[model samples]
Target: MLSSWFRVIRVKFLLASVIAVCLGLAINWWQNQTIDLVYAGLTFVGVIALHASVDLLNDYWDFKRGIDTKTKRTKFSGGTGVLPEGLLQPNEVYRAGLIFLIIGSSVGGYFIFEKGITIAVILAFAIISIYFYSTKIVNSGLGEIFVAIKGSMIVLGTFFVQTSHITMEPIFGGIVVGVLSSLVLFVNSFPDFDADKAGGRKTLVIMLGKKKASNAVWIFPIIVYGIIVSGIVLHVLPILSLITLFT
Candidate 1:
């Protein structure tokens, strides 16, 4: 049952949020020449909690809308199979999601008190985005845009909490993660194209059609590499940051 809860939270996929937070920390250290382990640790936990909330809530919404029932489950794209399999009641997932969201928000609230209203703004927007993402954003054809902003904000917020100010490095790093994360959402939407359409939802896949949207996948990597190379060329980033290209 504990393991089932892990699966419900999609713990493995939570790495994306972890990576974004780490990227922010990396930039903070690179600029400030110091690290705040306690703050960074708390930020990581808060970010992951928020991420789990999004996953659980998404599962709840998808099942409610009947999208999960129609889409063929895959190792990569489909919703976690727990709800459809009857491993947990729908309300259980919904409550769990809310619990996680509250935990994450409390952490953010602490940061806002410690730091300033800037953190408050970021946290407020993030919480709002997570709540609306599955229901409203995905249906409005702005799903990809919302996701991209979500990833970018995670980096920015994490960095701001540490430094109490924003900078170009985190912005650049945020853009890289933003585009890549959106690419993940974009690609995943393909399998759900028919499911989304029938349910009155419109993802990037539904907006562009499959063939054209598939080509957009390559654009993400290109933009990521372009930012890295350009930042290096302009001396905006350290030479070592180039190594990220291989990854």
Candidate 2:
């Protein structure tokens, strides 16, 4: 039962959001040579809660729409197998997702109180998007756009909480983080292409069809590299950050 709960939350995939938060922290430290371990830690908890909320809510909605049942499950793409397996009731999963959403929102609310309207705006967008993501955003072919923006915001938001300002470093770093995160979502969507289309969810893969989508997947890494190169050339990013190219 405990394991099922963990699967439903998709803890394994939480690392992407964690890495994004770390990049934000790293950029802030790189620029200011200062650190706030307390706020950094709090930011991480809040971001992770939001990430989990999205995952659980996504699964709940997919199941509700019957997409989860029709889709071919894969290691990377399908909704967590928990619901279809009957490890938990749909209402149980739905309630759990709400709990995580509330927890995440509470954390964001605290940050808003401390940081002001900037945090409030980002939190509001996140809450609305996450709640409707699987049902509305993906169906509109804007899913990837939202995921990418969410990744960038995580980086920017974390940096803002710590440094109380935005700068080129975090902006460039956020772009890199955002693009890479989108790539993960892009590839994962491949397996769901047919399922998504049949369910009326018009993801990028569905919009472009399989072959064009495969060809377009290369663009993500190129954009990441392009941002890195331009940042280095413009001297906005330190040359050492070029090490990202090797990654």
What are the root-mean-square deviations of the candidates from the true structure over C-alphas?
1.2, 1.0
Candidate 1 global lDDT: 0.90
Write candidate 2's Cα lDDT for 42-158 as tens digits: 888889988998898898888888889888988788888899888999898888878888888998999898889999999999999999998889888898889889999999999
Model 2, residue 174: distance off in Å is 0.7
lDDT values of the candidates?
0.90, 0.89
Once superposed on the true structure, which residue ranges of model 1 sit more than 4 Å away at CA?
none
Off by over 4 Å in 2: none
Best by lDDT: 1
Question: Clash pairs of candidate 2?
Answer: none
Least accurate 10 contiguous residues by lDDT in model 1: 72-81
Candidate 1's displacement at residue 238, Å, is: 1.3
Query: Which tens-of-lDDT digit does each residue in 132-240 have in candidate 1?
Result: 9889988899988888888999999989988988878898889899988998988889888888888888898898899898887888899889998988898888899
